[model samples]
Target chain A: MSSTLLNQVAFYLLSAIAILGALGVVFLKSPVRAALALVANFFTLGLIYFMLGNQMIGISQIMVYAGAIMVLFLFVIMILKDQTPEEDKSLFQDRRFIFGLLSAIVICGLIWALVINPTMQSFGGEMDRSYGSPQAIGRSFFTTYVWPFEIISILLLVGIVGSIMLAKRKF
Target chain B: MNTFLNLPLAGAVYEDIPLGHFLTLSLAMFALGSIGVLIRKNPVIVFMCIELMLNAVNLSFLAFAAYPNSHVQANNAFESAMAGQAMVIVVMAIAAAEVAVGLGIIMAIFRYRNNVDVDDMNTMRG
Candidate 1:
């Protein structure tokens, strides 16, 4: 089979898995179930990244989000240990649900506009291919995008300090 | 192999997959994630939804990185690929930090309240 056909097949198949898993994340009431669905969604997203030829991003997607972060989420939920004996029945029809539904619709419409708008269509075609490789990315990071790179490092440092502060009982 | 047989008709039009397709899928995922954030009362699920949205944005950024239009004049493939990949790496790093801090807050809240219900956060209101 031609390479084009291979990519197409891969994209749609993976998209199905992703969309369904995302739906599961929203619909499942149990935090554990939702977290599990999210793991599936992250894996499907990794496949999409792979198809886009950002192999490194795909690897990171799996390792960081699916493997580490999500497991952390699950562990926390488990430790929370069902504190409420009443099952929180009102959770089903709360005000947050209605508001969330509205926000979702608005977000979806806006995204569709950005994606399908004729003006965006005129922006041009495929990007330069060097964007896919490791060496090129490293050069760009140290050069034209150096400021943002440093800023992100600072952000991570702040996050580390902030979380420690927040988690500390007397800080 | 008729790989296109499994794909939608739009897949057949391009010799290689287009960045637009990735963007659209990413957007779809983002919207779903947005819904998840708004709809879920559980703080942990809300955090998961936020992560999903971040990943969606990352996908689009990677798409642009992999297929830059700037090199249309010279058709220089290597430079565009490198630029895109570089941006994705940076974004991933930022995302990791956000998750760490964000989840840490959730853990602290759970410790104090013994409840993860996001709606209960309204105590700050006057």
Candidate 2:
């Protein structure tokens, strides 16, 4: 097969895995299992990003999301171990079920918008090959988008301090 | 070798994968995240779902950036594409911060109540 066919197959496979992983995140009984499912989802998304030619973001997605964020989630889950009862019936009851149905409707509406709307068709061809390179992204970050980069550093600092303070034993 | 490989001689190209397909996938993921947020009582799971939603939006951003119209000049292609990637980076950082603060809050609540159910923690139920 040609390269385009390969890419199409890869896209479909990755998307299927992503959607399945998302479902697992919602439906899995064990919190840890759910977290693991999310990790799978993130990894698939990273692969999708790579397929889209955004290698930097793809790698960062793996590093920050699948690596760091997942660890944090698992750590929190471990700390809160065995808190929820196994047979909680409240999960499937009134408000939750109603909201689930509502979200299903919202998803259907979005699908209609995606499929039936002619204006939403693909507009442009493939991007420049270097568009997602680390060097290109770095240049943008350091020059035109430097302000936001610095702000993110500050935000991370605040997050670190705030997390420590919040998790402290005493005020 | 050609017969064994069984490759398609000609058919749909990568361009045939419309922009709307990406958007549709993103939206479906976002909707799933929303439903997860609404249904799941565990704050950590809810937070994970929120991250899923963020990733979905990031995918859409990258999709748009890859479109041809995203660049006005060939020389400025990198600059144009950088717009979406830059936003994705900022959003990722913000997401990290949000997760940190959110989990911290959850930890604090768990420390006090010894449970992590959102439904039970109605201390400020005014």
Give Cα-based local distance difference scores for all models: 0.71, 0.80
Error of 1 at B78 (Å): 6.3
Candidate 2: lDDT of B52? 89
Give one digit per residue, the lDDT tens place, for model 2 in A1-171. 666767688788889999999999987879999999999999998987877678889999999999999999999888788885352566667676687868688766966666525436536544466778889898888999999999999999999999888877573
Off by over 4 Å in 2: A85-87, A90-93, A107-116, A169-171, B1-16, B70-77
Q: Assess each model's interface with DockQ, reporting 2 decimals per model.
A: 0.41, 0.45
lDDT of 1 by residue, A1-171 (tens): 766676677788888888888888878777788888989999988877766656566878899889988888888788776852223467558777678777878877786787544324333454343343456556777887888889889988998898788778552
The weakest ten consecutive residues by lDDT in model 2 chain B span: B5-14
**Worst 10-residue stretch by lDDT in candidate 1 chain B?**
B5-14
Task: Write candidate 2's Cα lDDT for B32-116 as tens digits.
Answer: 8888888887778888999989988898888766655533675565567789899999889999999999989988887777878
DockQ leader: 2
Off by over 4 Å in 1: A84-99, A117-128, B1-14, B70-87
Tell me the TM-score of each prediction against the true structure.
0.82, 0.88
Interface RMSD of each: 4.6, 3.9
